[model samples]
Target: AAAPAAPARASGEEIKSPMVGTIYLQANPTSPAFVKVGDMVEVGQTMFIVEAMKTMNPIPATRAGKIVEILVEDAQPVEFGEPLAIIE
Candidate 1:
């Protein structure tokens, strides 16, 4: 079966994955997520971690704005250039 499409956003800048890997929304299992829907974020803020080739790489926000949506689930596999979040 085909996966459902992500909800269309009226206005927001998307944060895209830098590399193909598994995405972690939190620093650790018990830690709060780096950012969530409705949260305000600054440019360069760490938003997610993409583990590639056994290395953990922190993914930073490219623009400052309120996070409108998180497109990926915690620990989900992601592809390079995939949209991870929406900021407006």
Candidate 2:
């Protein structure tokens, strides 16, 4: 009998915050979140937003992948290079 194949693993890349700011999971409180764990995303897709210096900046995905982890909470403060999510 042939041996069973190994299960596919998530080679998720850790997406970090680009600046010091508050992380926004959705466009607004009433809006659905931009993404969540297990959601598939394309390159350049808006993953989240950050508010810094009174500006809202949308964060895009660097590559096409599925989200496997969310490391930050909605409206939570984040610093540059802080791991925000894991994309596979």
Q: Would you give me the overall lDDT of model 2?
A: 0.91
Residue-level lDDT of model 2, residues 2-54, one tens digit each, is: 98975554467988899999999999999999999989999899999999999
For model 1, how does the per-residue alpha-carbon lDDT over 1-88 read when each residue is reduced to its tens digit? 9999866664788899999999999999999999989999999999999999999999999999999989999999999999999999
TM-score of 2: 0.86
What is the lDDT of every predicted structure here?
Answer: 0.94, 0.91
Clashing pairs in 2: none
TM-score of every candidate relative to the true structure = 0.89, 0.86
Q: Which candidate ranks first by lDDT, i.e. highest?
A: 1
Q: lDDT for model 1, please.
A: 0.94
